[model samples]
Target: MNATVAIIGRPNVGKSTLFNRLVGKRLALVDDTPGVTRDRRPGDARLGDLRFTIVDTAGLEDADKATLAGRMRKQTEEAIQDADVVLFVIDARAGVTPLDAHFAEVARKIARPVILLANKAEGRAGEPGIYEAYSLGLGEPVPISAEHGEGLSDLYDALREEFEKLEAAEGPSEEAETDIVIDPDADGEEDDEPAGTVDRPLRVAIAGRPNAGKSTLINKLLGEERLLTGPEAGITRDSISVDWVWRERHVKLFDTAGMRRKARVQEKLEKLSVADALRAIKFAEVVVVTLDANIPFEKQDLQIIDLVQREGRALVIAFNKWDTIEDRTEVWTEIKYQAERYLNQVRGVAMVPISATTGQGLDKLMEAVFDAYKMWNARVSTARLNKWLEGVVAHHPPPAVAGRRIKLRYLTQAKTRPPHFIVFCSRPEQLPEAYLRYLVNGVRETFKLPGTPIRLSFRKGENPYANKAKKKR
Candidate 1:
């Protein structure tokens, strides 16, 4: 097994900054506030030629065993136990505090190969803290400015030395290796369509209003209380991402804080949480908008769905807490009718009835999520698109504007993943929005693409002699 390194430190000491530096992605939320991270997140990290798993853990603190801080501390302790090496970081600008010393003692008791990292040590100003770290009983401190990407060579050397010693002590074992190849053109045709692959992990985000059972549904999918949940609204603050395998297919699930209406969101913390949820939706390929079945399709819920569609993300509507509702048939009919009438931009979005509390209809929900993802990344042959365009134009032609009939020439798919199309025609600006919507709906229905945003752009076809004629004139 590859060596795993865990980062542990007191709050606001730049552990998350260093974690993001090493992981090469901002997977963890970083802010000035203390205790931003409450759960452990792992990523594959690379330094020079070395590759291993690196875990970013919550900050350690002194609190009652029953409190939330205590639970975070337990998570950090668990990460330490599972790690082959530990990075105990300290804030060089603030110098060592009592909390640092307390955590240093805890790290010593754990007896793991600990590397002392004096973060925020960009210049000579951090000298005092570097000197103070020598008294913590850990060896020479590796001073680094993770945000500035400095002193990583020394950090790499320290990690390599420890990893080598461990490997030498354990010796070698026989293990089978499998090679994974990624082909860029695997998802589309070679002629006109862009090539891609679905082998990547599905990125799904669960979002809705506060206390809409978003976290509850994710917990049910994980089959564990990986997330903290209760009757309390807005229990989730940071957008926590968890990796799981469903039926041997890789899936990355993001549980975000519930979104509230802009005017209703007053607290600074809740605003940050809502912004984090928005960021999650922007990054996600498929977003499952969870709603309380008892009060489905509220104004806020409609607004959330509108935002998702505006972002051009594949969407799935999950009616959470379905078990609590009494009249299933009537509710389902109303939901279908409302979705058809209201969400006409992307018609036929998948709507699944689920109970996050009782684990009902989760299978259908995931199946719909995968289906939406597939359709979102779907590609159509140019020949097929042109044929469909021909038929649609024949059925209902483009309207005339100012005594001139707009000529519809040709259509070609420019991209996928919320499929975008380019149409070459005359007087493109004369086309009405309703006419464009007609073409988009035709493409969606003809190609079996549903629940995914469709984009169409019109361009006037180029004339070879136009430039020459302009020059002569």
Candidate 2:
């Protein structure tokens, strides 16, 4: 991977589809719904012989001051600035919407070269719209059907041209920079647990809207008021972190400042507080988004889930103040349903209804955390995976595509942390979502693991290999 090519566009324009195409993996979710993607999704991209780093970005919406969309816009702009080439995608069939124009205008400000991609252009329906995309004023729209694997030759040509320009002028893009800033003796207060007892302690960040029991949960977990909590909002600031010992396991716990809706955060201190909280999330492996049981579902809460998915981190959603809810059963069901409905990108997210006050379900919460952590670290033996793959195909066969039954040749666990398995087969694109879920559910059931996010991607290939890549992180 050399050049950093960012997949950019308005919502639902197949940017993620093209990213997966080049990356040779379903690393990002592909849904028909607009604004499905909400964060910077970086993948090791291979466009034939041209290997480059591709960043799949959220749709750029013209958001007003103090909104989730506004925050996303800020993040997306940062990604564009970092990119070497911006692949501006537009939905050909949908024909340039108003938002498309807005995005194109915004993209012109970036110093990098921008190439327009007219996606979903396989059929006759998209011909006129593909031609219409020339109005974006970047360049000729490279018509591509990302889902059907059409029009990569043109994309390859465009990439080659950009690389040549950079080589001739900029003298070959620099090596991948080390982003980690190791502060061996960074001036900071100590956490609860001793430092050296653990090997790479899991970084778990706790976050939620103001007064959402985030500090309370941290206090409860540490068995002390390590972080100050108050009825007044914004008690914790500066993103205070501590090392925690849970059942002999060590974790570096980041108790972040309370994130409020941007509008209410008028003061300078509050804005810095929000930024500190965001930084905590960036440095976390697993984020425990503690929600107020009474007021759980908010726009900011959905944004938090979006952040977790974007960061590619395992999440354990803890509904705090569970004891306060009057109709426990009803509220719990409703909250879970809403979470599922809103955040569907990461399948099977671990959601626990627990009270941080009384410690009821904290044991279950810890148990769930361990399960999620294990799932994150889960590595299936290749021999065992293929063996189980054979059994799954033999038992409940893949459903018919048009007329022929889908043929699944083999399977391999690509990567894990929520256990991502890839099945190689004939007509993988045609494979039903129900069939894929059936296999994923089967794998979870077979392993006796439930409630952890399990991702099973069906690809049309045999034995894809990463030569020196280890099975587990």
Candidate 3:
């Protein structure tokens, strides 16, 4: 296992900035606002020849145990316990505040090796703060500027020493070797591979509005308090991804921040969180949009579902908090009616009612997710598609446009995973949008592709007689 390093400090001390630098990417959200980070986020980090798992945690703060700030502090404390080393950072330009001193005392009590980082010590202004940090009793301060990338060499030396000590105590680790064999007798050619059957983990992202129990659902699935949750809305800020196996199927689940309407989202931090959640949707193969059973099929819920369909991703609507509702029969009937009414564009989408808190309907939710994944990756042979197309066209021929009937000559699936298809037709541009929808719906129904997005395009068929006539001339 790689060495784990956790960066902990008071709000606005550049812990996230240092994390981004170590990871060599903007994996964590950075802002000038205090307490932007709320959960512990981990990323694989590399510095020179050294490699380790670096964790970016929420700023350490003092608050009531029931409050949101207190919950954030708990997450940071957990990171400190899990890490092999702790980077206790302080803002050198601002000098050490009382909160810093208090956390310094807290860090001293932890058993892990603590590295005091006097961040923002790029110039003479930070020199006094660096000296002040020495009074914290952790050790000599390592002056480094996390933003401008200064004094990392010294920081690396400090970390290297700690890691060397750990290695000595734990003993050397053996490296695994992978051998690849090539076939010399076979001709080199790339073959079209099928989808959904690969050994890689299935990427499933859970998204919904605030307090929709997205984090709770993920925590229940993980069987641990992996994510910080409370009665507070928007407890989650970053889109955190967790890896797990469900019934021998490897799955990478992304728990995204709650998305609110644009008009209501006035803060820049909330905007960043919403953007992160949208990115998770784009990366996921299947998105589970959690909905509160009390207020099912809200305007925002439909909008989120529409966005997923527009992004050409497989979608499953999970009505969370099912245990809270008393009228099961009436509510379930209304849910089905509303789903059909609002989600007619993507017909036959999977809707599962689940209680994330009680684990009720959890099995059904997973089954729906896997089913949607399979449908998303479903592919059809060209022969079968064309044969299906013949029957479709014969049953309902294309309407005449400008006294000429448009003909669909052939249909072929361009790709799977939210299946895209191209149709060779006459006057492709003249095909009406209504007819296109008809064809898309036909494909969805005929191919048993429910809950997954379908893409259909029309292209004018190439005429062989035109080239033949030119050759004759």
Candidate 4:
């Protein structure tokens, strides 16, 4: 409703490039790589006399490579349905491939008007492809070079015409609305905890893997043997969401049975434990993932972080039994490096090195949960966020791909729970995944968003808004 346009197409067809172009800067990476974009990237864009929001989608490769069109395909279709207008981009260089034709069929199914684009038509070599693009049955394809910045004037004209029709047909009452809500944190606290809904106090889930002191730490944090404490693995079979208050911050700690791999969960109790812990993760607003200092980085740990990110919840990481580790210096360095490398998406992710038994750094651990919770509700103003991004890019330049320089254009927040941003750039495909990681880490450290996922996406701009606003006058 607030000026959104969706760019939908098959892989590597310069949709992202067109995104950057309309945005009037390189906010995305333009590369020859296909299926590089895995998520839909939304950006504020302007084209000639037209200014609106645009969304660039992941190439439809996963659909082809998929074993089945299950949940993911359904989600993708929903996302497409949510869009305003669909800019159907096709590769003018390759002409209309079978994939492109398939995409056109899908586009036709949507309620939105389709704007066909024959991108990568800079050279004389692409003229034949431009002609062939018309056969896809979405009306005439506007030829434009996403890479070389050619035929953009014609793109502006086409877009202007389409928007004019849209304006004429739409109700005049449709207007953008803005509100300033100052307090989302007040809503973070559980209603039942404060309201006394249950006489048995609160139910909190303190979950993690084997021997990360879920029992020992909960015991230490609670100062009791509420749950059995032992070095033996898989002792806590059922998830016990217990009640406690830390400095008057009421908590219902769920001491869960240690979760092992699904195949390794041979025992019925262990399976029950895993299931309970998973349910706890879903129910609880804030989930703390514990890690052993000795072996911190693991595939399961990363998966846990991803789950938290997807759940739109708050999270904290506690390095339990940190007091037992002798080589503290090396461990901290390794842990920091691994977190930055593996969990870059979790911006400002809270990392606390705590010893449950010794009670060392327990206060810091508690502090982190409060902080991460606050950050989960954190909203950065457009002015401050862009300012912060400007400083970050100025400090560390973007990485170059091949001979071409990667350009990061204007940046803005798309949405937030765990703060998400869209970076308009040239050659969004050309931008390396690692560079996106760099920006994520930078956002985490700079914005003080630790222990939360900060999604940073590169959007390629093409049809680069040919400054035809002057001519429109």
Candidate 5:
């Protein structure tokens, strides 16, 4: 594992800001509101030339053992335990509150090294807190402005000192740390694996209406209460991601807040939560829309599925709380019928009946997830695509448009992962929308790619040398 650094602090102490700064991406959500982040998020961080794994954790809070804040503290403690170095952050503008001191005491007990960071220290704003941080028994605080990107060089120096000591203690290594290298023009002949391997983990997001047991399902999959779950409708506010291995495949599971309809989402926090959930869906390769078995396929549920299809992501439908139903066979048949009748945009979507509380039918759900993802990334050779296109045209040719028959020359796939195809045709703008849908449906059925969005476009191909010939004339 890469060296781990954990950032810990009280709520609104700029931990997420520092994390975003180091990682050079807005992976974590930042807001003026406290407790916006409720989970431990990990990312690869770089400081100048130094690189390491950095973890951004929820702020420590004092609460009873069973409460949500208590669970968040538990996650923070776990991050501190696994971390090689702890970056204890404080809001320099606020000047070291009682909560910061409390968490600092806990950090001091740990055997690992700790570095105090007085964030928001731009233009001498955090000078008082820098001095106050010395009383916490940690080393001198490194003043930093996480928002403005200031004082990072000094922080880098301190981190480099710690890493140098670690390197000295662990001795030297002859082999390189990583074998992967970027070469834009290199051919594929040197690689040993015949088929390319997907090194990046598959990103799957579980989204649905409130109280659909989305978090409960992922917690069961992880075999731990990694996320906060309860009877509350809006218990989850952030789109939290957990890294897991399922059947030896690395999968990054994102559990998003329950998405409510636009008219009902009036609260500011709920709006933010819904936006985060939509962002998760956009980032995900496959989305499993969970439904309450008691009230399956509500208008909001169909709207969520429609959103996923419109976003061009592969989809799987999951019926949650299946153990509550008395007549299982009849409900299952009805649900399938409704899925076909209602979700016409994404045909042949995999639907699995699962009880998140009881852990029943999870295996089938995962199998369906993997199957849908495979179809989403599937690609067809141009030769086979053209042959299929010929058959399709021969069966049902394009009708006459304004008295002349429109000719479609050929079709070729432009991309995969929601396979996109472009057809060279005459009068592309005049091609009817129904004809395009016909071709898209044909592609889906012919390629066995079901439940994945397929894009088909018609383009009039122009001769490349025509411009040059005209100039010569």
Candidate 6:
């Protein structure tokens, strides 16, 4: 097993910057604002030859047990308990404050080792603070600058020492295995895997407006309070991903921050959060849009759904807080009507009513998710597509324009995973928008493709004899 290390500190001491440096990616949201991180985010980290699991946690704070700050502190405490080693960080420019000293005492009680980090110690400006950090009495402070990437070699030495002692006491562990294979004989070329055949985990992202219970739903799926959720809107600020095994199938679930309307999002931190959520949507194969049953299909909710459809990802609508609704039958009927009326582009999308707090309809939600994924990766044969096109053209021929009829000669599927098709036809520019819509709807209905975007493009057929004219002599 990989050694687990946790980075702990008070607010705005550059703990997240160290995490980004170690992981080699900007997976966590970083800003000048205090308390931006509220959940524990894990990533595989590599420093020189040492490899381990690193977890970034929320900043430590003191507050009432019922307040939000208290809940955040609780999450940090959990990380501290589970870690094999802890890195206690402090701002060298500002020196050690009362909060740091208090937390230092807390770190001392940990049965494991703790490395003191005096961050932002780049030049002479940080020397005084770095000297003052020795009073905390954890150990010799490792002076480093997380932003400029300085003094990491010293940090690596400290970590290597601790890891060596740990290995000596515990003995050699079984090395973790991986499934990727590297080829030594191949030239530089891209090897693309076919859809639905790669042995990778299925990626699913949950998104919606503020106060829509997105985190609650993900926590329920994990069967633990892995994510922080409460009677609060926008408690989650970062797009955190967790891996799990659902019914013997590997799945990766991403819990994103709640997106608010553009006008209401005035703060820089909220803007960053919204952008992070958008990135999660682009990376996912299937998106589950959570909705509050009491306020189903609000203006913002419809906008979110439209964005997902435009992105060409498979979609499933989940109506959360189902237990609080009084008239279930009436509400469900209205929901179906609204979905059909507004979401006519991708018809027959799956809608599942669930209560995240009570675990109602959880099984049906997973089944719908799997069903949508199957449809998203579906492929149609070339012969079947041409035959289907023939029947469609015979029933309703293209309308004549300028005394000439548009003739569609052939049809073929270019790709799957949001299936895209190409049509070779005469007068491609004259084909009306209504006619294209008819063909798209026909493909969706004929091939049992629903709730996924279908892309169809027209191209004029090439003249086969044009290149042969030069050889006529």
How close to the true structure is residue 289 of candidate 3, measured as C-alpha lDDT? 96
Tens digits of per-residue lDDT for model 6 on 1-473?
Answer: 46899999999999899999999999889999999999999998989988899999999998886898999998898898889899999999999999999999999999889999999999999999899999999989999999999999999999999988888888766543553446532553322332232256678999999889999998898898888888899999999998877777667889999998889999999999999999999989889999999998888998899889889988999999999999999999999999889888878889999999999998899888888988888889999999998998899989999999889999999987789999999989999999999999999999999787889999999879878986885
Expressed as tens digits, the lDDT of each residue in 191-293 for candidate 4 is 3233113332333456667877887888788885445555566655445545677776666676666666566777554565577678777776677888787
User: lDDT value for candidate 1?
Assistant: 0.87
Ranking by lDDT: 6, 3, 5, 1, 2, 4
The residue pairs in collision within model 1 are none
RMSD of each: 4.2, 18.5, 3.5, 22.2, 3.8, 2.9
How accurate locally, in lDDT, is each candidate? Answer: 0.87, 0.76, 0.90, 0.70, 0.87, 0.90
* Model 2, span 1-473: residue lDDT tens: 36899888888888878988998976565676666555565677887778788887778888873665665566577678778888999999989888888878887777999988899999899999888888877779999999998999999999899988877776533553654546533645333323324745778888888788887787788886445455666656546566788887778778777787778888765676678678778877678888888887789887877776666566788888888889998987898788767765654667888887888788788767666766666777888878888888778888887899888877788876557788878888888787776787678767755545667777776444544355643
Predicted candidate 5 versus true structure: per-residue lDDT over 1-473, tens digit per residue:
25899999999999999999999998788889898777788888999878899999998899886887888888888899888888999998889798888888888899888999999988766788788888888888999999999999999998998888777777876555776766533665432221122446678999999999999999999998777787768777778888888887778899999998899989787888899899999989889999999999999999999999999998999999999999999999999889889976898888899999999999999889989988887888889988988888888888889999888888888877788899999898988888888888888888898888888878997878999999999
TM-score on alpha carbons, each prediction: 0.83, 0.49, 0.94, 0.48, 0.87, 0.94
- Residue 348's lDDT in candidate 5: 81
The parts of candidate 5 lying over 4 Å away from their true place are 168-198, 266-272, 381-409, 461-473
- Write model 1 residue lDDT over 301-389, tens digit each, in one string: 99999999999999999999899989899989998888888889769889999999999999999899889988888889999998988
Pairs clashing within candidate 3: none
Candidate 3 Cα outliers beyond 4 Å, as residue runs: 176-199, 467-473
Alpha-carbon runs more than 4 Å astray in model 6: 176-199, 465-473
| Candidate 3: Cα lDDT at 164 | 93
TM-score-sorted candidate list, best first: 6, 3, 5, 1, 2, 4
